[model samples]
Target: MTVLYGIKNCDTIKKAKAWLDNAKIDYTFHDYRVEGIDADMVAEFFAQLDWQNVVNKRGTTFRALSDDTKASLSAETALPLLVEQPAMIKRPILVHQGQYHLGFKPDQYAKIFASA
Candidate 1:
């Protein structure tokens, strides 16, 4: 089963969901805001993706963080932060067949599914 993780109101997540629906791909949307995220799940993402790739540095959530929090960010520090504040993570993280893809683009999704 394919699992898509992100916040519901994010524009990127909206676009990704639309793309998946249009393509008729079956996937379960894991809305971090509504469903919440856990440390183990965040760790799983960290195992497959770099902290830099998973963290959304440009988002408001990250910007609003304390300077100490931003400066001290590391795998250990980020795990709890991500679990507590899912908005700090990037949107539309797709996990399929044990493979993980961060972010989304039509062509990228197409290639990923084709390769799968």
Candidate 2:
């Protein structure tokens, strides 16, 4: 099964969606913000992903956080904040056949699908 997780409005997500559509790969999209998130889902996201990669430190969401919140960020502390604010998570995490990938690139998508 192939699943894509990200906020719908993200430009990166749009690019990934377009790439998938053009590639004719069917996938399920999980918008963590609107659909909400649970511990299991969050845990699954972190299974192969590092907190630094999973968290979008460059985005406004993360930038707006209090210094104390930012200072103490870690694997243990990230989950609760991710549950409360999914935007803090990076865009377009593509999971294919149980393998997880973060962000989007045409070449990367092509390679991933080609391997199938």
Per-residue error (Å), model 2, residue 116: 2.4
Off by over 4 Å in 2: none
Model 1, range 1-116, lDDT digits (tens) per residue?
Answer: 99999988899999999988988899999998788889999999999998788999999889999999899899999999999989989888999888999999999999878865
Q: Model 1, stretches more than 4 Å misplaced? A: none
Please, what is the whole-model Cα lDDT of each candidate in the order they appear?
A: 0.91, 0.89
TM-score of every candidate: 0.95, 0.95
The clash count of every prediction, one per candidate, is 0, 0
TM-score of 1: 0.95
Cα TM-score of candidate 2: 0.95
- Deviation (Å) of 95 in candidate 1: 0.6
Q: What is the C-alpha local distance difference test score of candidate 1?
A: 0.91
For model 2, which pairs clash? Answer: none
